[model samples]
Target: MGRYFRRKLLIYGVTFVIAVSINFAVPRLMPGDPVARMLSRNKVANPESSEAMRAYFDNVFGFDVPLWQQYLNYWAALFKGDLGVSVYAFPASVSSVIAGALPYTLALLLPAILLSWIVGNSLGAMAARNKWLDNGVLPVGYVFTAVPYMWLAILLAWVAGVILGWFPVAGGYSFALTPTFSWVFIVDLVHHWFLPFLSLFIVALGGWAIGMRNLVIYELESDYANYLQALGAPRRLVRRYAFRNAMLPQITGLAVALGMVVGGALVTEVVFAYPGLGSLLLSAINNQDFFLLQGILLFIVIGVLVFNFLADVVYVLVDPRTRLGLEGGQS
Candidate 1:
């Protein structure tokens, strides 16, 4: 197990280096100069003033330096936890901007992902055992999974927010209410949060249900289940084993989903105008904010690698077959 983990860590380390390099490269490859965009947006006219501002902006953004030096400086700054200044929200540090937006994304993602997984898996497992449930869950699960995230978000916003007037159409909370710990504020937050959360939850719920249903059915038909039944083991006992075995893949899927939480649902965020990393990223891109874009991408890369590592650790802990395979490979 120790050797196995060491190897995994080495792989992850190499992957991180490569991913970070790609993250750094991607934003620079994009067209348009961020500094120029900022100047244009601010309307910094006049030859002397424009030149002075352009030079200042270039120096501050490290565009005056060679590409190789900039890359090296990026790594150095990254090591010291400096994500640099944002181009879109000028004068604000990239880290601070991301920090402000992180909570909203987490609030939306965590509950949606976890609850959908739990409820979907339960429904799928139940459906696997009952013919009537299988008929209903199968079609509903397919439909839900097939719907696009953005379209569902729009539909929900139109029906629930605009037409029905049940919830506010956009924003994280009501503009009138200042962010505070009061009951009124909390209630308003939840009110705006519900539609976005529902869109994510309902979409995720379908895929898990379908996947688990199929896995459970396959597990129940596997040789071990047949043999257990042949020995006159209780049907419940056999199903308990099947469900446990079927959960291994679902655990992996859960890890991957959790890993992607940092990226969030870009289209959904855009549609709802929710203040999250996804919307922030879109702003970064539109304004050619390389620092912010790379910073967000870096977070995404680190998140995926970290969560995937956790998943590997979990697989070793829960699945004896994984351990045996490792041992066999070592031999």
Candidate 2:
């Protein structure tokens, strides 16, 4: 187990390096000059002043340096936790801007992903055992999983926010309310949070349900299950084993979903105009804010790598087969 985790850690470390390098390169490759965009947005009209400001901005952003030096500086600054200043939200550090939005993204993602997985897997397992439920759940699960995230978000926004007027259509909270710890602010937060959360939850729930249902069915029909039943093991005992065995892949899926939380359901966030990393990323792109975009992408890359590593740890803990396989391979 020690050797197994060490190997996994080494692999993840290499992956993180490659991912960060790509994240750094992709933004620099994007068309247009971010400094120029910033100057234009700030309305720096006089040519002399514009030239002076451009020089100043380029030096400050390290754009004056050669590409190779800039790459090295990026790594150095990254180690110091300096994500650079945001071009779009001028004068604000990229870290601070991302910090402001991180909570909302987490609030939307964590509950939605976790609840969907738990409920979906339960429903799927139950459906596998009952023919009547299988008839109803299978098609519904297919429909829910088939719906695109953005489409569902739009449909929900229209029906729930527009037509019914049950929830606010845009923003993380009511613009009228100042952010505070008061009951009024908290309630208002949940009010705006519900629709986006529901959209994510509903869409994710179906895929998990369908996957779990199929896995459970396959496990129940596997040779071990048949042999157990032939030996007159109780039906309940056999099914319990089947359910546990079927959950392995679902665990992996849940981990991957959690890993992607930092990406913040990009299209859904755009549709709802939610104040999260996804919306921030869109703003960064539109404004050619390379620093901000790099910061966001960095978070996403780290989140995915970290969560995937955790998933491997979890698999080793939960599944005896994984442990046995590793042990045998080592031997």
lDDT of 1 by residue, 1-331 (tens): 8899999999999999999999999999998888888888889669899999999999999999999999999999999999999999989999999999999999999899999999999999999999999999999999999999989999999999989999987999999989999999999999999999999999999999999999999999999999999999999999999998999899989988987875547888889999999999999999999999999999888888888999899999888999999999999
TM-scores of all candidate predictions against the true structure = 0.97, 0.97
Q: Quote model 2's TM-score.
A: 0.97
| True-structure RMSD for candidate 1 | 1.3
Off by over 4 Å in 1: 262-264, 327-331
Scored against the true structure, residue 123 in model 1 reaches a CA lDDT of 97
Q: Candidate 1: worst 10 consecutive residues by lDDT?
A: 258-267
The global Cα lDDT (0 to 1) of model 2 is 0.92
Lowest lDDT block of 10, candidate 2:
256-265
Mind giving the per-residue lDDT tens digits that candidate 2 earns over 127-235? 9999999999999999999999888999999999899999998999988999999999999999999999999999899998999999999999999999999999999
Best by lDDT: 1
